[model samples]
Target: MRKNSIKNIRINSEVQKELSNIIRTEVKDPRIHPMTSVVAVEVAPDLKSCKAYISVLGNEKAAEDTLEGLKNAVGYIRRALARSVNLRNTPEITFILDQSIEYGVHMTRLIDDVVGKEEVSDDGMNTEGDEGSC
Candidate 1:
């Protein structure tokens, strides 16, 4: 099967959803932050391997701990995945730390800071003009 085939896309979404549910409800590791989420899932076309992108809303230590927790629980996770989803072969999951969400948030804050500064300068100039006119 092609990488981007309709079947592959469907499988990816299904696996992503199931993995999210499993992590949210089944996993009971303190290291796994409560704000952990599965960002994306890519199951190989051959169904032999999978990459699961995970995003954790916490400090770097929390994220690293979450990854470690997930790695240690990979066996149970795979078994859970196998039971939840029917497939020819249960793919080996590779947990990947995805920082795209955090990056987007940081970029937004920078843009907002720049905009705020511009607004302040604009207001100061306007106030000076108003004082002169008065």
Candidate 2:
């Protein structure tokens, strides 16, 4: 058996890409997480399993509900994928809701807050820049 390289990843990745397109264009469910973006796809070397990373753009009850909706529609999506992809076996798809986007937003807000505070202090509010501070 030859070792699988990045090229070997193309087939499964194509499947994932196809699935993304279909979901965006075909899946006509209002609850299918409109803000959801397919972040990445990782297929096992055997091509029997894949974990899809997805990010939802907002933080609210709707976001949570959207993820739940995506979970429920996995089967239909997979079935649709099988129709278009010419493969011996269509890998099982698993959706993992990525919170990295949310984390990034939170981090950005925190940084902005810090910068805002610094600006206020620089206006002679807490300018105790003595030998004790950096």
Candidate 3:
């Protein structure tokens, strides 16, 4: 049952949504940062386990604390999920820090830096060519 079928996709989205809401409204752990967000959710095809990718807007400390908070509240979150969703077996929740967004931003900055340098060199070359012509 490793297929990524339509039903699995739907269940993933539903779990992601419900978890996000539960975290935002129900969970009151101080370690959980206010800027934490559910980036994505991957549910097993058997619906026995789930991995929730979370992103925290602060530094490494915030990310760690948020993850710790989530880990400590896993039982509560699972119960909440069981109550909210109609799944036969509630998936065991695991929170993982997702740095994909931060990595994308860093890559974009590097690309812009390279492009900017190339444009400056091109401009200098054009100026040199014009001077030689004149």
Candidate 4:
């Protein structure tokens, strides 16, 4: 069930912060890129499951390897989480690759290129689409 109560929201917020810290510092997988960061954390109201969104740095191969490494290290992290937090039942953690940041970057570059082309053609310059200017 989704957390509807204020107390549950607070608990989730605290858990997210703690888990973000734990995941950021505790896991030392060589596969993980140095620029990786926790993008989001979602915990069930009952605290049985947690979904972590992580952004990977470098190429696609690096991201895939990092994900595999994170999956393998989940157990160790969960145990550490149980010890660090005062929760009765530690949530099962799952890692997801967060690509929205990369997608946004790609879109931004595309927009910039389009704007640059437009600026270059601003002074009565015509390519294929400008029959009137031609």
What TM-score fits each model? 0.96, 0.78, 0.91, 0.82
Model 3 sits at a Cα RMSD from the real structure of 1.5
Query: What C-alpha lDDT do the candidate models reach, one value each?
Result: 0.98, 0.77, 0.94, 0.82
Ranking by TM-score: 1, 3, 4, 2
Off by over 4 Å in 3: none
Q: Candidate 3 at 5: error in angstroms?
A: 1.3
Model 4, span 3-108: residue lDDT tens: 7677667767776677677767888888877777778777788889988888986789999988898899999888888887888689999999999999999999
Superposed model 4: Cα runs more than 4 Å off:
124-134
Q: CA lDDT of 114 in candidate 3?
A: 100
Model 2 regions lying over 4 Å from their true place: 1-4, 125-134
Model 1 misplacement above 4 A: none
State each model's C-alpha RMSD to the native. Answer: 1.0, 4.3, 1.5, 4.1
Cα lDDT for residue 101, candidate 1: 100
**Whose lDDT is greatest here?**
1
Estimate candidate 2's alpha-carbon lDDT, on a 0 to 1 scale.
0.77
Writing each residue's lDDT as its tens digit, candidate 2 over 9-118 gives 77757876887887788777787777678877877767688788878787667677767777788888888888888777777988888888889989999999999988
Please identify which of the two predictions, 1 or 3, would achieve the higher lDDT against the true structure: 1
Report residue 90 deviation for candidate 1 (angstroms).
0.5
- What's the TM for model 1? 0.96
